[model samples]
Target: MTPQQEPPPFLGTWARVYWGVVLYLAAVIGVLMLFTASFRL
Candidate 1:
């Protein structure tokens, strides 16, 4: 027997939530890289 699971609160599905988190992490990394590059001499 299998147990029922609940959907993510925001994105509705687990896959979408995972993708959203990935995209958010990528964006944050990109911004941080840019910030670091600008400060480099």
Candidate 2:
């Protein structure tokens, strides 16, 4: 099999990776909302 079958180095598990992505997306959305509110957009 290819290296894709192995787990990530830092996070280790795919579940953690998924959660990390979710958190990142949430953070980005939160920042955009704050920016929009500040600009009254």
Which of the numbered candidates is closest to the native, going by highest lDDT? 2
Report the alpha-carbon TM-score of model 2 versus the true structure.
0.75
The regions of model 1 sitting more than 4 angstroms off are 1-4
Task: Name the lDDT of candidate 2.
Answer: 0.91
Clashing pairs in 2: none
Q: Tell me the tens digit of each residue's lDDT in model 2 across 1-41.
A: 57988888769898999999999999999999998899874
lDDT of candidate model 1 versus the reference: 0.89
lDDT of 1 by residue, 1-41 (tens): 33357776798888999999999999999999999999989
In model 2, which runs have C-alpha deviations exceeding 4 angstroms? 1-4
lDDT at 25 for candidate 2? 100
Clashes of each: 0, 0
